[model samples]
Target: MKNQEIAKILYEIADLLEIEGVEFKPRAYRKAAQNIESLSVDIEELYKKGQLEKIPGVGKSIAEKIKEYLETGKVRKLEELREKIPVDIESLSAVEGLGPKMIKVLYEKLGVKNLDDLERVAKQRRIRRLKGFGEKLEKKILEGIEIARQRQHRFLLGFVLPEANAIMEELKPYVEKISLAGSIRRRKETIGDVDILAVSSQPEKVMDIFTSMKRVEKVLAKGITKSSVRLHGGIQVDLRIVGKESFGSALQYFTGSKEHNIEVRKIAIKLGYKLNEYGLFKGFERIAGRDEKEVYKALGMQWIPPELRENRGEVEAALNKSLPKIVEYDEVKGDLQMHTKWSDGANTIEEMVIEAKKLGHKFIAITDHVGSLKIAGGMDEEKVMEQAKEIEKLRERFDDIYIFHGIEANIMKDGSLDVSNSLLKQVDVVLASVHSAFRMEEKDDSPRNKSDRK
Candidate 1:
């Protein structure tokens, strides 16, 4: 709810701080913002309880800022930062692979301040002449800008999921049965819109409540059986009410990959049946409609998981009764790659471990950044050893879960790791990642690149 709004402002503050070359405060703000975004409870409720500081990563200053926002609906510090920077920093940051440091460089070097300015510079080939940027990187920036432009109206699945769930919770009281459908139900990484289907005896009442939702920015249409509204974030949501008899059919039809539906339709026709949103029929007698399983069974196949309904051999697998079993969310035991306060993460080792234990984890790895990635407050050999000893001591206090001491080491441009092999051998796990040189797309077939690629 307000968590996202607060997090966004704090992120902007972080960006401005970075642009102005303020170091530690930006990290602090970013950490606090990240923790706030992941919070399960309402931030306002935490403020009312005077427990804002208790949230991991939030300190006294940040807590006061949160209180200020809840009270005045704005953070004064962010407003002041915006005034000084005088750029639409958020839009510029949305381009892939463009970090705050680079943004600052672009501003200082070419007076580029926004997406349009960056695009103009790239087109003029001026960006390639800048230090640390070449033709390849400049081209990539142009592509990234275009992609960001295309995705402006869409939202990430992770970002939109909580809001969609909240909306579903609100509508539960009014509908007989409701299900979320569309790309969201299919769990696509980015969603253009949300589709919700419900079964209700009083369709008109359902439509009324859907249109009148507090978060509804505008009602596009309202009808007896269907309604459409735009949410606060420009996300379009469509709600459809269907009879109980057609609920399953409606769900199947709406929760579709167009290709998947075509294949299923072809199968139905081969079996002497006609399928539609209302029902699967054999010469006018309804064979399956009330239950999704019935529809699949009638076509001599097992019901497919929504995620696999992409016409990617799923239909064939279902027909052969050889569909692979997908892992349930609960089956995941632990996270191997996560940060704690030892590096750039907001939470402390104990706090992170405690949260993981609460989630029923059997084990987890504390993979803080190591070596030359100074932006993440990377640890050196001495600090890594110190952290390992601390983790060992912490292990004695908790027997419910196993903790692995690990480091996320940076891979240097020359194909060497930032951390020494001797130090890496001492840890339970090592995660090597590329933090720079994101623009060079062609594999460096040079001997150095070849060895590194290996």
Candidate 2:
């Protein structure tokens, strides 16, 4: 079948699955459509070669449909589905909590095939007074219609992150692996959030957790094709499920800032290759790449880190193979400054050490505010010495880590260190900083002549 024809079929299937309340299945079709759309290969050639299955998310059933499309001009299954459903699929699908099955019911029983008809029924109090739906459900459905119309264009990221994390955590017990992608993963800070890609042997249970998140907010859209909700913080989150094989590609595609992927595409084009969210494509074929590394290696480039992927210089660097070594979390060996309850911090000297140990740190200095500022509960010399004694005691408890007694000594107006040399020498580290002198004039720090000070 032509790609558009397949896309239409997939869209219909997705709609039906949503109305039918089958979670994850809709994502399979959507992913299929996405994969096919991103292909650089001639669809006709792939169909003839029976290589459609090589595409992520295109399983045996979809492949057969493609073959049938190649043999004939139209898809029988799609035609049958179209005939079975009313012409106003989009309108009927807009009603919240109503999917294909509900659509069928609305069409057959109520003669309602669109939002206008559904709204009229709702206003007439007919649906509210129906067997299963009450006044509350009808109100919810009406609210859903408004939301569907207003947010029909874009998603917001501020809302999507928490819902994604909650769903991922819920599915953790059932699946060994799951990841959130789309704008949220891109660290866009604000997002038109996309679906959470979860992989598991027990996909049914994983999908159940997704629908279960409905209680946290309200289910705005639900289908076997896709499920979306307005989470507690007014965030709309979508969750997609695919087999383990498709997880890598789907995650990459969904998590993309399209501009960055366009850069990847440029690289692919230069190297006589094609790249998409699914995997690296080489002239109508999927190259073997189960992960992002493989995808880049297939394109003859180093792995492109996510942070450097604002589409700025990524493509140029990739082609030249001169990408800078971006810092990773593991490379941080020490925290230069932190606080303790001896000053105004949350933890005590002992408790802070425990916290640092949990983070796998080698050393941490308790640079408490001392004497200069009253707001931070700055300590005097006696209190600093008392804190030092506590630190010495805690030192015996930990042999693998170093705990330093230090102070964030204030910088005076003349650019001099606040603490005297006697106290400064007693500590393992010193971090002199200006807490209140932010407006001070810049100073040149070459050794001044003693005669100038006099």
> lDDT tens digits, residues 1-454, model 1?
6788788788889889998999799989988888898887888899999999998779999999999987886788988987777777877888987988888889889989889999999999999999998998898899899887776767899988788898889889888899988889998888989999999888888888889987787999999888999885568999999888888888889989889899999999999999898999999998898877888898999999999999999999999999999988788899899898899877789998898998889899999999999889899999999999989988999988999999999986666788888998999999999997665656653455565463
TM-score of each: 0.83, 0.52
TM-score top scorer: 1
**Regions more than 4 Å wrong, model 2:** 1-166, 173-177, 182-195, 199-208, 233-236, 242-246, 257-259, 288-290, 311-332, 411-422, 434-454
For 5-66, candidate 2 gives per-residue lDDT tens digits of 46556777777666557798887887787667545466678877868898777999888877
**Global lDDT of each candidate:** 0.88, 0.70
How big is the positional error of residue 325 in model 2, measured in Å on the Cα after superposition?
Answer: 5.2
